[model samples]
Target: MALSNNNSKRATLGLGAIAVAGLVSTPLLAQDAHQLIRDNCVGCHTESGTTAAPSFSRISEQRKSPEGWLMTINRMTHLRGLELTSEDKRALVKVLADRQGLAPEETEGYRYLLEQNTNIIESGINQGLTETCGRCHSEARFALQRRSEDEWKYLVNFHMGQFPSTEFHSMSRDRPWYQIAFNETAVELGQRFPLHSKEWSNWQAAARNDLMGRWRVTGFVPGKGEFAGWMSAAKTAEGRYDVTLTGRYADGAALAGEGKATLYTGYEWRAGLTIDGVKMRQVMAANEQGTALDGRMFLAAEREIGGDMRAVRDQGKTELVAIQPAYLRAGESTELTLIGQNLAGDIDLGDGVVVEKVLSRNADRITLQARAEGAEGVRMARVGTSKQLSALTVYNTLARVEVLPTDAVTRIGGAGGNMPKVRAAYRAVGYSVGADGKPGTEDDLRLGYMPASWSIKPADEVAAHEKDDRYAGSIDASGIFTPGDAGLNPERKRSANNVGRLKVVASVADGDARVEGEGNMLVSVQDFVRRVLD
Candidate 1:
């Protein structure tokens, strides 16, 4: 099947440009964007003139979420004979995000869900819709979409046709799903989130802002620590932005970074940078107003540690910026502080969240005692109209514990020939079950990230009998696994000294309740069997 083609077999009502953007390069007047197509992509993709692969232009022609591009890249690599290194994959994906990504204006109300940060969680547009739509996939996946009612109906039809058993799924089987989708869901979805909007038109017509100045950055990096910093970005060429960052982690360690980025559809952002000797990547959304960039910056080496980042202009007027430890247990109360500029007045902690009393307040900071009282899901952390999403989730009890990256990888090192060791930081994600008492169903709630006691053991008891844990590595208090030094042990019967499968386990003791989760990792001798691309 072709990777991407414009409604090759499906009906597509002209919904205007799915993702809007101004051309960044010089106006070539002919074969401009196509030249780019042939330059980078034509090596593999081709137009239907008589080829098996779809044209590169088809990709540029359609609009999609970053997830869509990732799914495509994953498919191409695993199934369609595409080859790439991690860095190469990142570069290609960033290129597509800028070249064929959604406009920030079109994605305004959806930013909360789209942001890849820990301070927030997925929230549905409404209760009923949240259950009907969000139960299966992320709310951002749905929020990033816009369609006519008929087109939305067509989507349901497509799902039914493509996956005939979908209607029989637990979420669907419990209700009149098909009927509701055709009547209530489709109609309401179109009204609540229509494919056409004046918001996009206005933002698209407005003058674009250049991100070529000093920016104040605030964020926390999981595992390593929190940081405050500044950056200066210079646009070197069309769509090319170069950034220099200087910052300090919470522990006062010097942090620095430089990065190259390509702006996608004007607002979609992706970049790679290094800070404080750590190599990382940035996936963010640029606001239409051009005041801020909010997203996640993650370690590039592995799915180890990541956190949220916000970059705003230094001179811009600021209000209550953020809430430290933005969450608390329902019955228990904790002091929540707001960090920002030009702050004042009483703060509204959104629905279900109650601030018992303001402990203190100042121009840039406000400390207050608040209780969640079992108010699960999210409430806007609001100060008037200004608000950040997923302010809090208070639960009566922890429903379930999950090990993020349910699977992981790390290499065993020995001698001077061993490659650099990579560590895995496991975090326990807690959830609260709602009325249904089901872990994954709609009523289930997210408890954000929770502290856990960590341990490591052999995933296989047979491997344990082989003394895998003894030969493997050690897990630290914060869930970091330091693999045993790379080397084959002469005492072992196997020729290889220290290679085996391990289970990283995290446990949390809450009074009489003990919650635990585990993830599997294979301690390999090498980074790759046959390294392909870099």
Candidate 2:
């Protein structure tokens, strides 16, 4: 993997060098973790006190996510020349993460980084920290850790010492960087994220949840459709599970898979599975109470092609979670599938909508032939005592159309690059202007996702002059954008890579009229270092 440009140099320093080797290794037993760490790490990270380096006790003073510890170990391997077998490195990371990991609550608001959600727009972070730390790497890197004031200050010194260029970076050169980092930023970080907390203590004391048995699952894949399923977990090893999922999409397409999951910090759930022969990965968190699992699942090779997942333990309680094909054309009949746990009882599709007949019924799902009539508005679907708000919408016509994400990004890769290209998916959402008679007003009704023809064009004059739309990428009929190849192209001016700034347009057929929606997209260079976090 090659660094794209000079701007990424500081980010590389902050995030550490990518581990080119020692990533593929045989798994070791959990009992060997301590021995592996002692043999490989004790020389520098001593057992008792700091001598050549910090002691294990000192290292234990800080808590971090598994990715954080992995980066630290990777840094040691690349910088300090600490050599270890792949198995040993993996064991060290697992053991240290278990022994000195953040509590579940401590990682809130930053899970997107761990999940590799690249499109998130970070906000609400302190300006001081953003200017000092986030300029190089994501704010999530520091936000996910707990440290003492002195440790935070020590980190600032370490950065400056290791990367002297930090003092000359854009934000650093204008201010007393070290002084502010040491006195104000470190103090604020310590106060905000102390090494000691009741949450951590309580989490440590609480019993870990056993993720075995069946769970009701619901998810929505963008550009695809909503799906409902059930997952079964069998204990394969301590803190590990073998999972099987069975379900179907709203269009009645079959969805089934088998995967393996490893639990960390008692709550974080990581899994890799092949669903319908397509490889996928899941980053979810089991609730402390052990009832729900919620997070994101995406393609292992293409992280952009995934969906939001929500699941609950199948405890035989009637719970309505979702209604597939959630929108209906007023006065038109359609098949509806209600998914949840122990689904039973009289069915109701709110007012003006009637269930013509029950197609199928089961403890986890219910299929019905239903029709909407007389009105255009959001409807709550009910099955017995369980009801889901806004589960279904009845719309007469679309007053306007909007792209799901107003802004997006894709990467050009696969020209002898280690990282594969990241594709961007789009969906056109239909809306009714509602009784307020305004398209963009609060009362506007969200009809739902609609099928559309997708196209691309230059976003601005510069893009047009550069012929970006011709070289950047292509949007297919299904609204998936596949970027052009990586590396410089002789056809392009200056031999630049096939990168561009463009517009993604979606056209939806609405009777005699065509409703159009447009979104901005940037076809950028490939990421060289793909870390566990970010």
Candidate 3:
């Protein structure tokens, strides 16, 4: 992506010049890509060049996913006090994601793990992984990254250097940390995941897509419930987009909004929106190949508390994009529809799925009666060779609800601060027992993640006395919380609804059984403003 403004001293911030210098993959978007870094980063990150902080060029050698870049920026802000507007932070994250982000295919097999907080301890995992990497952090932290073996080696060295006692840590001392990391694990990691792959390279070279049209959107926010909306994207400026979203929260509340966004790397998407007076932030990925745009949208100030944001052009090319419901109960029938470009044909719903007949067919939609007969896995349907679609045929049975992220944080608001109160977004995943009669075994069926009714209450004795119900915030049926403004009134001592620990609950009903999962939420005062005060 080429920025319209290329002559400013700050223009060097764009990867275009560097791409030409063969420093990295061809940059997709330019201009505003690295404005945040140019304004605050260059002062020490590059201007100092060889000081304690590494230069941007040095850091550019490494590749990371969108979340990885956010982690780095967050580390800097928290430790080094890097200042940036939330908007700038969002843009900077998008810029780095475009330049260094990993392709979905690159992080395959780990999306579910990275997405949900899974229990690796009692679960089957890669040999030696738990003892080595999992000892200090989550697999989600390491699994999504792509780096050359040497880069991985650098990481190992960095870890040991930083920790000093890493090798002597109980988990590593018993095992040869360096020997396993450098020889066996490192080699395995390198072979399985390398920084340079055709996936990222091709994605890097693709033309930036101008998302100017209507889109169909579906996603669930933990505290807000499941929402379906339509968004209109129109080009408002070079590389900048204006968006209008209209929809309804699952509770039947009207949802409507308008926002602005910047598209980077032909796929990395960032948008600032407002819905019902709540400011929101969106970090989504657009897959041109799949002709789909999907990512997360959350409170403008709190990213962890967001919901999935997915969209397809109100209409597109010869693509069999999806099969609603994605699965069916064996021996049961479901009326399935094909959503794609020029979707036409005798529908094949997959093994054990027989399209009773083509109920209807339009240029962009096709409907059929499909029956699932004892089918249990992914099934692909094809219309001759033009359309190949995939869906799941499974047994619809209540299993267990797996809450996502394990934990998340939401914050209280301040005096007229643009930082609208943050709401925690939770995902409820349902699973079916496998052939082994267990819910977690390899044979267990995946029912997918979804939204649920939300509830929140005090999680501790302190919260109980503080009367979190009246102070922390009130959680909606969708799990959204509108925190009490900052300040201590007669009801409290602290000068704010600044702090509270609450339990965010997601309740999902599977037939007659109502299942619920809980996660912790730390509702505190504004982080950035508080940091600034410090």
Best by TM-score: 2
Weakest 10 consecutive residues of candidate 2 by summed lDDT: 1-10
**Would you list the clashing residue pairs of candidate 1?**
98-264, 413-485, 413-486, 414-486, 488-497, 489-497
Full-model lDDT for every candidate: 0.62, 0.76, 0.61
- Give residue 24's error in model 3 in angstroms: 19
In model 1, which runs have C-alpha deviations exceeding 4 angstroms? 1-209, 212-220, 226-236, 242-260, 287-295, 300-322, 350-367, 372-377, 384-390, 437-442, 509-514, 525-534
lDDT for 487 (candidate 2)? 90
RMSD of 1: 11.8
* Residues 1-534, model 2: lDDT tens digits: 101111111122244322211221334454465456567777776576433333464476688877678778877887788887776666666656666788888888887766655555578878988899888778788988999888898888988899998989999999999999999999999999999999899999999888887888888665456778888988776567888988887777888999787677777777777787766778888898888899987666555666678888877777887777678878767887778887778888888998998999987788889988986777787778763443688887778888856777778877776666778767788888888888888889987777888999999999999999999999877777888998999999999989999999999887678888899898888766554422
Off by over 4 Å in 3: 1-57, 66-101, 109-133, 142-195, 205-208, 236-239, 250-252, 288-290, 316-534
lDDT of 2: 0.76
The candidate, 2 or 3, that scores higher on TM-score is 2
Span of ten consecutive residues with least summed lDDT in model 1? 2-11
What is candidate 2's CA lDDT for residue 522?
Answer: 84
